[model samples]
Target chain A: MTTDAAVELAGVTKRFGDVVALDRVDLRVPSGVIFGFLGPNGAGKTTTIRLLTGLARPTSGEVRVLGREVTSAGFEVSSRVGYLPDVPAFYEWMTGEEYLAFVASLFGLESSVAKKRAGVLLEAAGLAGVRTRIGGYSRGMKQRLGIAQALMNAPALLVLDEPTSALDPIGRKEVLDMIEALAGKATVFFSTHILSDAERVCDEVAILDRGRVVANASVDEIRSRAGRKVALEVAGDVERVERAVAAAAWCRGVTRVGARIEAAVSDPGSAQRDVPAIVAAAGAGLVRFETVEPTLEDVFVELVERAS
Target chain B: MRGFRPFFLKELREIARTWRIWVLPSIVVVFALTGPVLAKVMPEILRSMSSEQLGGAVISLPEPTWKDAYAQWVKNLTQIVTFALVIMLGGTVASEVRSGTAIMVLTKPVSRPAFVLAKAAANAVLVTATTLLGAAATWAVTLAVFGEAPLRPIVQPTAAWLAWALFLVAVMTLASVLVQSPSGAAGVGIGVYAAISIASLSRWAVEHTPAGLIGAPGALLAGDRPPLSWPLAATALIAAAALAGAAVLFARKEL
Candidate 1:
């Protein structure tokens, strides 16, 4: 594990009964980076979170958090990692303050410090006024409380499993804001199927498919690899333009329907180079021309599909 | 100790919120309060039955004493209250894992052994309190009915009973640690109990062996055959060892 990396998994494998949940997976998340774990359901996102947080042991391979081996130094690593499960549950009998206080004490916080921290965290998570029983909390409020508890120790790494999956749009935005705010100070390894949520907050991402990480790179790197897609709506001879686009050197594939033409291009740079020539050669009158950037969603679907 | 304090408090709170605390105590208290009254009144009711309704039943009845009431209380406890407790808290440890609440705790700096120990301590305290309440209630009623007819002889038996209760709870903790669900834990616990009982039934020297620790309430307060000091001692040691085993298992188990 590098000193700069908050979490590192080297060829980790985990199995549940007959199912291989995670297989030879490797991930390295730098300290103070918002790392997105993007995968569809059952793509081993939660399994990775459990392994990183020391909630579950890997069937084989090594896991390190905060530069310490997980199984052997779990206590040391866990003391520095705060985790929120996909569905966080608190002792229903407790109030928000009480629950956070209990979590703080588990981290060996002094009573005065724990209370002060809990108060500040509850406020930060937008749960300040919700002093009632946790059982009475709405799903969103519970999620907010989950965030509050996860950040209780101000851990070096914060692992949130599908933090925004079950939330409404507003709730999702709130969690994203909390995650974004933690950047530059704490390493955030957030797992989610919500690509928009990842795009909204993550600095780096790993797209997992079928118990393996298919793509691990920064948001920019993934977008760069996916390339850009250009959609052009032309007024004339769509079939002629399609034939012309098929022979264009800069384009990968082109499809047309009635007046609309969409092309997967080699590069956005080349789109400017080759699009006009193709349009002029076919003599098509273009109504609209637009360039679309690849999003985290596209990258996720592509990786999952390619892996399968 | 910090984690144990908070976790134990949390466990107690769970017992309070759920039906576990009220269900068994209600049954035991009801049985305790009604035992003397039922014993006192049952004979008269039997005598009042018409000959045809009685179907040629004998008319004369034995006087209802505190001994009879105590007997009734013990019978009800052995049959119902203890069983309710076992069924209710059977999955205390398993529920946390199944519900993923254990994730919240294990991710903290607290040790897994502390987690298991806290749960065991909380369950032990709660069970002991309720059982003692039932015992005291029974004793009070029996005293009022039978004029305190030398109840000291029962104290040793009651102590032995408490020991077995501790043993039962230790086994439940072991079951809870081993299984992932409450129903699974209860099944394992009951199976452990049955295996022990069947073993105890054998007339071999092993029957009287400390392995008799497996038969809890039955082995505790059976007869003038006093609680075996060696067996009781052995069971306590084994129960402690089992609890330690559970702690070790939970420490290594994936949440």
Candidate 2:
């Protein structure tokens, strides 16, 4: 295990009777970076998070957090890891302050230290001046409070399972902003099916498909390796422009979308050189021609499709 | 045992905020206060009705004593307080599991055994305290209403009843850990209680199992110096075993 790795799993397999939730999954999340576990629903993302948090034991192989075996060093390792489940529930009677203080007490923090930290975290989560009971808060407020409680101990690794999954757009943005601000403070390992959210804030991502890690790399690496997309708008004879682009050797695939031709190209330089000439020869007026940066969505779809 | 104090404190807080703290204790106290008053008023109530129902025939009977008052209190505890205990603690662990609250807390430094122990300890402390307060109230009322009853008679029976209460709470905690729903937990608890009560009808079971403890209080209040019975030992053993069993099962639970 690398010293800088915050979480490590080696050939970990978790089975519930005849069903295999995670199949021989291997992963390494380095410290001090935001790592995104991207997958569709029922893709075992939550199962993997449970294993890392020591809430569930793997059927086989080793699971480690902070370089310690999770099964044997459960509490010792858990002390350094903060986790938030998908739907976090709190005591409805507890106010935001009371709940955080309760969580801090579990971590054995002194009362004074816990009080100061709770104040800072509440402000960071935008829950300052909210003295109402948790049951009275909206979904967004509860989610924000969930984050504050998870950060009560200032854990070295914060594992959030779909923190923003059920939130509105505004709530999603609020949570994402809070996660983005924790970039250098802790290693965040959050799971999400929303590729755009991962792309917006995650430094590195691992895409899981049907209980296995299909793709794992830095966001930039995946984007660059997924190749580039080029779009062309032709003013005349759009069909002819599409046919020309489809027949071009440099283009991987081409399809006409509305009045434009979109193509996936492995070689951007060659496609840029060859596409315009082909369109012009086909007697079509080229209105717009530009290469588009590949998105995480594109990479995710391609990887999952290939794995299946 | 790590996180015992924090978890226990949280359980206590929950009991205080919710109706469990006041409702169960209030019920017990009300029953205790009414027991002696009911015992004292029975003859007067019957005499008034006898003139009309029996054509002016006077019904004669001996006056009620402190023993009768104590017996009335024990009867209420066995029937009413037992049900209250089961309902109050039925969802102690199951609700937390269903709501995903257990997941959040258990993922921290808290051990599963510590969580179970804290929950059991908190419920035990609450039930024991309230029962004792109710017993004290009964003793004071009986002494004022009836002339000069010794403290030993009331104290002995109250101790016996408290032991049985502790056993019931342990069983309820185990049931909560075993089942997934609050109602299911209560069903198991009440079922086990009924089964034990039925089993106690047999002479062999009365001498061997914890079932004998429930009736011990009533018998003691009637001035029967029943020798230190095997069921008393069995009750204490079963309570400890139930707590240990709960901790073990909770540790293996997936959530």
Candidate 3:
């Protein structure tokens, strides 16, 4: 394990019989950062969460969480970490307070201390003054309570599995706020299929696709790595303009979809300077010309495409 | 052993709040109050009902005694209470796993062994508590109905039956941990119970295994002497082994 890492997975391969869920996956999340694990559905996001939390063992490789091997894992790491599985289920008979109190007890908290923490967390999760049992809670309410219970111990590391995958826009924003507020307080590692949610809160992210880590870097680094796309719409000879733009030394790749030509540039500065001139020489009216900053979604799609 | 205290307390609370609170204890308490009364009046009720059915012919029946009251209580426990225990506890572990509740608890600082042991301990305590209450009720009703109720006779068979009941609890615990569906676990539990009951026909099996205690209760209530120490020890040993097996299996199991 790295000295500063809160989680490290080295060449981890997890297979269920013949089907590989995670293929030689490696990830290192630093301490005190909200690390986003971004992937599409069935992209080994949940499988990695299981391995990192000691809920499942990898087929072959080392998994270290908080400097302890999670395969031989025990309360040593568990005591310091709090985890919320996706769509977390609770004792339907327990109220939000009661569930948090029960979670507090699992951490060996004193009764008085547990009660105090439960009260505070319930308030923060917007569950205060609601004493109804969990069975009657809405999906959004249960999700909030799930986050509250995971925070009962004030753990050093918080792991949430697709915390916002099932929530509405408002609920997702609230959860992202709760997670973002934990910055510098704990190492927050949350997996999500929502790219915007990752871009909104995470300082670093690893994008997984078909059991492989396609990209892992800070949001800005990954965006810059994908570089920039200069997309332009011409009023005439769109295919001819796409060919001319593709043949330019400055344009790495160009695609024509209808009238717009979106080109991947080796250097955004040169492409931004030369795109207009190239379109003018081709005798095309430049209806729209703009340098598009590559989004995390763009990077994800590009990487997953390349990896495939 | 870590986290057993809180988890056991939570289990007890769940038992009190869920359908579990109504199922097993309702059967035990209702039977305790009614079984002995039925035992005392069964002859008269049969005589009246069978007179017309018998076409005016008379039938003979043994006079009822305090032993009959013990027999009544034991009968209800063996037939209804044992089956109820299997069905009630069958989902104790599996339902948690199916509902994803076990993931919430097990992912914490709680060890998997502690989770299994806590559930077993809670069920044991619940069984012991209700059995003791039902026994006291049986004794009181027997005294009121038949006047010569010696406490020793009631105590003896109740203890013997309770040992068997606790063993069933252990078996159901193993079944609950082994099967993922509540109904399937109950089926497995009942199948084991049926197998053991069928094995009780052999004198050697009855004298040496938990199946022995099934009939030992009747013998003790009837003042017939039968060897009990072997079955008692055997049931305890096997119950312990089942519990240990449950804990070990639960530890290795995936969520």
lDDT of each: 0.80, 0.89, 0.89
TM-score of 1: 0.92
The DockQ-based CAPRI class assigned to model 1 is medium
Per-residue error for A30 in candidate 3, Å, reads 0.8
Q: Comparing 1 and 2 by DockQ, which wins?
A: 2
Instruction: Give the 10-residue window scoring lowest on summed lDDT in candidate 2 chain B.
Output: B220-229
Candidate 2 lDDT over B1-255, as tens digits, reads 899999999999898898777888999899889888888898788988888899999898778888778888889888988998888788989989998889989999998999998999999899988988998999888888886667888889888889888998899989999999999999999999899999878877877888778678888887887544688888889999999999999999887
Per-residue CA lDDT of model 3 for A122-167, tens digit only, reads 8999999997999999998999999999898898899999999899
True interface contacts retained by model 3: 0.90
Looking at model 2, the pairs that clash are none
Question: Which rank order by DockQ, best down to worst?
Answer: 3, 2, 1
Q: Ten consecutive residues with minimal summed lDDT in candidate 1 chain A? A: A267-276
Where is model 2 chain A poorest over a 10-residue stretch in terms of lDDT?
Answer: A242-251
Write the residue-wise lDDT of candidate 2 on A158-201 in tens digits: 99999999999999999999999999999999999999999999
**Each prediction's number of clashing residue pairs:** 0, 0, 0
Off by over 4 Å in 3: A234-261, A278-284
What TM-score, over all chains together, does every model reach?
0.92, 0.95, 0.94
Q: Of the candidates numbered 1 and 3, which has the greater DockQ value?
A: 3
Q: What class would a CAPRI assessor give candidate 3's docking?
A: high
Clash-forming residue pairs, model 1? none
Task: Report the Cα lDDT for residue A148, model 2.
Answer: 91
